[model samples]
Target: MVVKTLNGAKAVAEAVKNCQPDVVACYPITPSTHIAEEMNHYYANGDTKTFIAVESEFSAISALIGGAATGARTFTATSSQGLLLMHEALFNAAGMRLPIVMVVANRAVSAPLSIWNDEQDSMSQRDTGWIQLYCKNNQEAVDSVIQAFEIAETTLLPVMVCIDGHYLTHAVGQVNIPPQSEVQDVLPPFKPKIFLDPENPLSLGVYTNPSHYQEFREDLHNDLLQSKEKIIEIGKKFGKRFLRTYGLFEEYKLKDAEFVLVGLGSVMDNVKATVNELRNENQKVGALHLRCFRPFPSEELKKILSGKTIGVIERDLSLGAQPPLYTEIVEALQGTNTIVSSFFGGLGGRNLDRTAIKVLFQKIKSKKPLKEWIAQQKGDQK
Candidate 1:
């Protein structure tokens, strides 16, 4: 194990190299650019074999699909508009069951054109049939990248490992890089089940009729949902190998809590800090961080939050609807008496301090959670 201080993007790139992917497809996009930058450096240093600098995110993912379809371990990176551009390819890759791993530096979608950190980009792709994993810090970002490839290949489903854009991507922190031998032991070289081979030509992406189309969709759905088992299993193996454990969702101080906060990505760090402060002040508040979003982890959430009032903090919205994650929590708690509320903050790279989180917990205590937007901590002079 080698511990080094590295920014999120570079950390992820290093992990990718350590896992020894066969084909690297990348396009430079804000926040995510450094990932490709570092990987290109690896290629220059003879650490990688085939690195493709594609024209656009669409082309990048298209190249990824091509590479993976040829039975090669592949990777790519993108953010915001770049990710949006790859929407169609995203579905195609997953539907074809190509276990390509992508690192999405999560950023807000654009119209007014802002380049900053948020969850909207990846959140918008929730229905694209990809397994989405959110990271809280650079260490986890690096760790998840290695784990992602293993998970993706195991399930024959593509995986999107998401990290907050500038918040995490450009932030340097200590990350323990697993040795190549160790990583290889855990994530052996890719042995694809299906591929485009000429000598043993096999048909892939066959056109489907109405009769089988629904079954195809259903199978994909069930496979993604059932992937939770493989995720947990691989996570445990990773823990045993790397001495770090991860869960579908992480619970912070939830025991005997009256209210619980839920969210994904970097904001959970602040939530944990605020929860600690609130606990010292005799408040019964906790936080649950969603790590794996696509699997939804409804049953686990329900078990942990059955009777507690739930406060969901979101960095993205469904546009005039309850925030995407909050809606999922509500649906997950269908038979429970637990109250669910949505609080939106940190959109477009806005700052969310512990004070704002403290205010949110206070508000949850004083009032039942109504869907609301949080901009500032109370008592701040604007």
Candidate 2:
């Protein structure tokens, strides 16, 4: 399906169909409703094997975990409070190493109760042991979901395909859906190496005394530590099969850039456009977007920012401090003269346009400034 106007939700649904998941579950929520609705459509048409409609996001994921445990290729999606509702289950899915793939339409948390796009929703699950992958556009949104499943299954860990809410979730854009035959050829059916079975069933999430708990936890951590390279390798293979290339870190005009902007999610297109226009006028500016965050490409970031000044446009703010993503960027580029600065923008679906990116360039050219307020996370999730 070569779609020209599908938003992130439809694009993700299309990709799921192309990836041919065995089970998909989700609950309705703003920005994420469409993804579920579309997948439900596919299920209605008999293209999808299982379409699970549940009472809440919590139940939706619970169904997914059950299906995955039964050796079914399972998938689920959520955003904002829906994500928070499923938080405990997120821990269960990861700890049990179910290799479940989820699509998180990144959205802002509520206090005044709003349906808006922000990174906090997924970022809140940073410590849940799920592999977090951010996308720069609809194409990446679709591509990452397919790639996410591959990585998750290989590592026996859950993965979150995080896309900018509203930015990609609502915006109509051109997306390249792979040919059915190619998708099938590239992605083989998911066969669980270990699962719940009648013949031989093993206890999952069992109580391990200090004697074995730490060892399992360490193995999980080490598996994730090893996923950085495996993800890159799987991404390369996925890209080659689909005729797409993902370098894990995408760089634009960073060759001789003095001031560069590093961003994640769908705003990357706007940043790329602004960079091109400004560079034409002799501005030493560029942009580097992080596609994978959890297994952060630290070495690649260090190499790219070596001796170059870079600014991080943080859409997700950190309470009582600079943006959370900004903090990570500074840490990654530390020990180098790279003057990494932080510029926070895009909250509640605010417009982060080319003009805003241009303005950010001016600020970077001058001394870096901090003018954004951090909204405190107030839910029990904190």
Candidate 3:
């Protein structure tokens, strides 16, 4: 293990290098650009070959698709509009069961055009048939990248390791870059069972008429749901080898709590801090930090949140409907007495501080289902 101070992007790049990807195709975008730059640096220094600098984000993912179709371990990174641009290829990669890993530096999508940290981008692709893993900090970002490859390869599904844009990507912190040998032990070379070879040629993403298209989608959906077990298994294996265990979601002091907060990504750090302070005051408040978003752990969440007052804070909205995370939680706890509420904050990189979290705790304690915005007031404490 090498202890080094690295920003999230560099840490992720280091992890990717250690994983020994066969090909990397990327288009640089804000917050995620540094990741692409770092990978390019590795390629320039002869540490890696087959780095493709593409014309656009679409081209970047297209290149990865081609590489993966040939049984190559592939990777890429993108953010905001760059990610949105790859929407078409995203489905292609997942539907074709390509085990490609990507790092999504989560940023807000445009109309107003912002380059800051938020979960809007990744959340928008929730149904794209890819596994989504959110990181809480830089070290977790590094560990998640290492685990993602194993999970993807084992399940034959693409995985997106999402980090809060500038919050993690640009923020420097101490990250342990596991030795290459250790990583290789956990994630051996990806030798896929199928590929585009002339000797054993077969169709991949061919035209499936209505008769077979629905069946293909159903199989992909069922496989994605079943992949959750592989996710948990790989996470445990990584933990045993590296001494850093992870799961579908992390429970922060939720065992005996009556009021709980739920969320994902970097904001959970603030959520945990506020929970600590409130606990000191004798408030039975806890936090649930969701690590895996896609495959939506509904049953696991229902078991944990069966009889508690829950407040869900999210950085993205579903427009005319309820917030995405809150909606999922509501559906998960549907017939229960869980009393889930929704709070939206940090949209387009707005700050979500401890003060806002405290306000949310107060609201959830009321036991009345509600929807509100956090930290929007000018008078709110920073």
Q: After superposition, how far is residue 286 of candidate 1 from its true place, in Å?
A: 0.9
Per-residue alpha-carbon lDDT of candidate 2 for residues 156-273, written as tens digits (9 for 90 to 100): 8899999877778888878888756767765777888788899997877888887888888788788877788878888889877877767577888888888888888878888999
Candidate 1: the clashing residue pairs are: none
Cα misplacement distance, residue 323 of candidate 3 (Å): 1.0
- The segments of candidate 3 whose C-alpha lies over 4 angstroms from its true place after superposition are 29-31, 377-382
lDDT (C-alpha, whole model) for all candidates: 0.88, 0.81, 0.90
The deviation in Å at residue 79 for candidate 3 is 0.2
Give the range of the ten consecutive residues with the poorest summed lDDT in model 1: 373-382
Q: Candidate 1 vs. truth: CA RMSD? A: 1.6
What is the C-alpha lDDT profile of model 3 across 147-208, one tens digit per residue? 99989888999999999988889898899999788798788778888999999979999997
Residue 293 Cα positional deviation in candidate 3, in Å, after optimal superposition: 0.5
Q: lDDT winner between 1 and 2, please give it.
A: 1
Model 3 deviation from the true structure expressed as Cα RMSD, one decimal place = 1.4
Q: Rank candidates by TM-score, best first.
A: 3, 1, 2
Model 1, CA-based lDDT = 0.88
